[model samples]
Target chain A: MNFNSAAFLVFLPLVVCLYWLLPFRARKYALLMASWFFYMYWNPLLILLLLASTGIDYLCGLGMDRFDGNPGKRKLLLCVSVCMNLGILFFFKYWDFFGECVSGLMAFCGIPYRVPSLNLILPVGISFYTFQTMSYSIDVYRRKCTPEKDFVYFALFVSYFPQLVAGPIERPGDLLPQLKKEHRWRSEDLKAGVRLLLCGFFRKCVVADTCGIYVNRVFDRLLQANALAVAGAGALFCIQMYCDFAGYSEIAAGSARLMGVRLTRNFDRPYLSQSYGEFFRRWHISLNRWFTQYLYIPLGGSRRGLLIRLRNTVIVFALCGLWHGARWTYVLWGLYAAFFVCLESVLEKPAGKITERLNIPLNNPLVIFTRRLYMFLIFIPAALLFRAGSVQEVGQIIQSLLAADFSLTNALGSLGMTSFSIVSLTLTLCAMARIYDFGLYDLPDNGNRTEEAGRQVSGVLMVLVIALCWLALLATEDAAGFAYFQF
Target chain B: MQEWVVLRHPELVLLYGLALLLCLMEKKWKASRGWLFYASCACAAAASAMLILQGADLREAAAYLTVFLLLMPGVRA
Candidate 1:
């Protein structure tokens, strides 16, 4: 269910209230039931897939424990678990994508072969839950974590409502232990949860949704768009995407926090990064952590050699791109990132020398600022590729952007914010967001006790103001569905 | 406040400016209950400013105060 929807608005509070009121032993049961109810709210039958995944991993974990002394049996069990999770993911999520690719290939080869496409519905959260469960099985096989013996806890861990759909992709080591712990009411946790929820709503409703309006308007008319429209849409899209995904992450983390569970930090103000390598480290941190632990490191991480590392990077990113969707654009976006990462590595020394030759201080503010600007400008094309419907759309966007008119009026008018005041407000809001990220107005946290208490009060006030703004905007605007929900 | 009135009056600028100032001051000085006092004042000032911006009709001011006060408990948390 959409987080901003009325159903979820009702569901979250009722669940949380009941959860805190329940006795400790029954709390998990209440949460598990609530989680299932939450997931089933979207589609009743899809709960079967969630349960199927949960059952497979639970048995796999137990089987790994059963065969702990036998390497062969453990490996076999791990394989079965991985294959089953991936198999379900493939059937539900990627089958149509695969079919279309094959059919296209056959057409290109002048062969009249065609694969029949199934009319299957892609289950929500299937991709996220599968990876979560698969990671559990792998962790168990590797002896990184003990297999969870209790079925209910295991199931709850797999279908935890907060991060169940769009995830911070919690690892067994982190999330499983929290599930086992007995939690009581903490005012501090509740305070933080409320703040995060407010911040999340403001970002989603005010920033992302507002940007989405302009982005959709321009992107939907790509064929008729001017250069300014394409560029504006591309830039706005980058904002929309980050706010949408990161907003969901914050809300997820906040909800989990309210339950006394700490989910991993998923975003770290990625747009503030000066480099693509740093961006990946900051953005969707949990996913990168997963791929690094499970895939990249296994493929001989940076330990082997530079070439191998590059190869691994490319493979991981390409797979990462494919993981986002069945679209070629996502694959290209991933490859685009991999290419930049490789380029950054190769140019690191040369660029440093050039800066030194230019008498630029290594820590010069100008140098850092320019690097941030350069990264953002360079990111525009990649963002365009991501927003495009096809490779040809990407080309058209680029061409239009290149052919953009130099007139200010055309540029400002293209995004439908023809009025100066609206544009100014939007820009001011964007600037405020940047300043907030940079901690320019950040209150000191670890200080005198009085100071800390005062800061807490101010923080709450900030939350209220944000929530007020969100409500004001939300009353006039429709909330946009999160961009990452498709994955 | 009505959209045209808000556009015409500079009261929003004053309220937003006061909010921004309080925010910055709170960030700068952590301790003092003085900051809390100012925050409350800022909220009241914003409401007053909204009323003035809307031409000081009690009904409009009441609406502004109602919305502002409604947000108070959440911030109190």
Candidate 2:
């Protein structure tokens, strides 16, 4: 079930309460049971897949440790673990897509050989948990961490309910220790968690879902939609996508925090970044971390010359795109990101030289704002590509975007944004801007100033915001699932 | 002698329970009691804010005060 559903709403609190109520040793079993139930809630049979993967990795980790002296055996176990995880992921997620591609190629050569399209249902969070399990095995193989002796803790690590589905994609070094620790209730943790829960729910239920309605409407019928509508929807989808995924991350971190367990930081207000390089650094921080550590570094990363670095960047991003889904659109989306990121890298020196020659201070507010706007504007096209059903739909969206309608009335009308939506979106967008860009309402930045009053007023404000947002969400009939859940 | 708005928020009983717990834990923890005192005060303020928004009267305010005054034990702790 998604974080948006009522079942999860009930399940999370019960798990948290149960987590704290049980004795330390038994908490793992309860959490494991809850996590399995949470996963199995989606597809009962898929839990076996999760368990089987977990078991393989668990054994692989132990094998790596046992055969530490023998390089061959250790390498063999590592290969087994990585291959097993990637094999299952490939079969479920990409088998049909690849099959179609291969058959088309065969037809082009006048060959009658056909690859059967296995229409397999991708198990929910298979992509996420597999990566997590693989990380565990790889980390153990590298001797960065020891193998988890207890199967229960390892299983809980693999399927921790809060992050079992959508994740910050916890690593063994970070999350496993906390899972094994004894934690009592702390008012601070409770307060912090509740605060995260409030903001997360508000972001997801209100901002993302509300924007999602208009975004989906416009994109679903890109043929009929005007330029203003397609472009506006593209921009809205950017906001919707960020809020949806970031909101999930927040709720994941928050729920985990309730049990006095801290999850890794996933998002860092990516929207406000001044450059593509910085935007990516902040966005999906965990996934990027995984790619950087495992893939990029292994491929010589930026340790080599500029050409190789750029090649590595393309490969990582192309795979990164594929990792999102089996779609060619996603691959293009990844290259789209890689292109801008590479451009920024290549132009970093030249841009600075130009700015210096022109006496343009890069730190100027106007300059910063322009950069932020540029990054966001660049993202809109990529957002279109990411959501499109095919490459052709992307071309349609781009065509519509080019046939621009410059009228304010047409722009507003095309979006069909009601006053309520306009008001709610404006308020939330302003909130995001203030929180991420300006840090006006930020607690961490103005710790001393806000310590007394911010937390106090937040109680009253948060309750109102949460109540209103949830009420609005419940009223909206087209409440969509978290956008990242599909991956 | 005074009124508290917390008791009028019967719908916010969880908030009341949390407020009581925060009050009880005020001095027992290693961190400064001010940490928890502010939490209790926030809870108190939220209850009042919610009650006022709900259009509470003076009698309801008085009942809230009776329930809130029970928090006086936290003064020493």
Candidate 3:
């Protein structure tokens, strides 16, 4: 069930209450069942896949632990778990795209071959849970973390409802230990959880959905849209996506926090980063770290020669894009980001010298503002690459942009919003989002009594505002699923 | 559309009005915020009663769920 869906709204509180009320020893079992039930509520049969992944990884971890002295055997065990999980991910998620590519190549060669598609419904959370379980196996093989002996705890870690579908992608070391502990009721955790839930719902239903209304319309009739409209639509898509996925992450984290389990932070004000390299570091932090650890560093990250580092960067990013979807658009999007990020890495020293000669402090507000706007400008084309239907659609957007029909009225009319409403609503959403995001990084200091009280009161006020807007959005717009769920 | 949006969910509109009115009262009655909260809560309860009296249909029930899940946490805070 989606976090914003009606079913999940009812499901979350009931699970939370049942979790707290259950006896200590039985809580993990109850939570495991609840997590499975949560996944099964989407599609009952697919729960088998989840169980298989969990069971294989659990056995593999145990086997690796048993053969700790035999490095070859441990490696073999890790490979079994990785191959099993990746095989499941591939069959379900990537089979159709891969088949189509092969068929196309054969057709182009003077031979006729067709790889029949299974036309399967890609199971939700396969990508997320696969990586999570593989991490457990890899860490075990690396001797970084012990294999979890408790099947129930390990199982729950794989299929935990909150982050199962869309994730902060918790590691075994971070989440498994918490599963073993007792989580009693705490008012503070509940309040914080509610705050996060409110903020998340606000981001999803209000800001993101509002943007979606406009973005979807423009994309649906791409031919009718001029350059300005497409640009506006692209910017809105970026906002819609960030708020949508980050909102899901916060809600997931908040749901776990209600049970006194904290998931890792995902987005960290990525739009405010001063450089494209910094932006990648801040955005989808868990995924980036995963690639860095498992892929980038393994290929001799920065330790190798410059050419190797660039090659590794490109390969990692290309896979990253493919991870988002099995589409050309997603691959281009990943390549687009890698291009800018690599440029920044190569130009950092030169840019530093220019900044030094310009005699401006890096912390200067105007300089920061310019940097943020530059990054956003860099982001717009990447967003187009991400949301476009095909390479031709992206080309059309760029061609129209070059045509110079940059009329504001055409843009607003195409999206069906007046200047006033969009601006006011955008400002309101951004201000509130900034307030909450700032709190995520730097909470109010407890030592300052009055400031802390003010922070609490402001939080209450923000939640109330978020609730009102969230309700209104539901009353008006069509509620869409979280954008990341497709992956 | 009007009936779907407004006629079926008058209580939601009314309760939201009460919530915003209470927020405005917080500024005017700083020393009596607690009393204002309790009083606003009574109005909200009465608004909910009005909704129940209107009977339960699927669409209206959906509206109620939104208020309960999305809006109530704010009211509680």
Give the per-residue Cα lDDT of candidate 2 at A177: 90
Candidate 3 global TM-score: 0.86
Residues A50-149, candidate 2: write the lDDT tens digits.
Answer: 9889999999998888888998999999999999999999999999999999999999999998899888888898889999999999899889999999
Model 3 spans with C-alpha error above 4 angstroms: A438-477, B1-77
Worst 10 residues of 2 chain A by lDDT: A434-443
Query: What digit string (tens of lDDT, one per residue) describes model 1 on residues A209-320?
Result: 7677778777777766788778777888888888788888878977888888888989887877899999999899988988998999999998887799899999999999
Which of the CAPRI classes, incorrect, acceptable, medium or high, describes model 2? Answer: incorrect
**Per-residue error (Å), model 3, residue A450:** 9.4
lDDT scores for all predictions? 0.75, 0.77, 0.77
Q: What is the interface RMSD of each candidate, in Å?
A: 9.7, 13.7, 9.9
Pull out the clashing pairs in model 1.
none
DockQ-based CAPRI category assigned to the predicted complex of candidate 1: incorrect
Instruction: State the displacement of the C-alpha of residue A329, model 1, in Å, after optimal TM-score superposition.
Output: 0.7
* Candidate 1 second chain TM: 0.42
* Residues forming the 10-long window of minimal summed lDDT in candidate 3 chain B: B68-77
Off by over 4 Å in 2: A434-457, B1-77
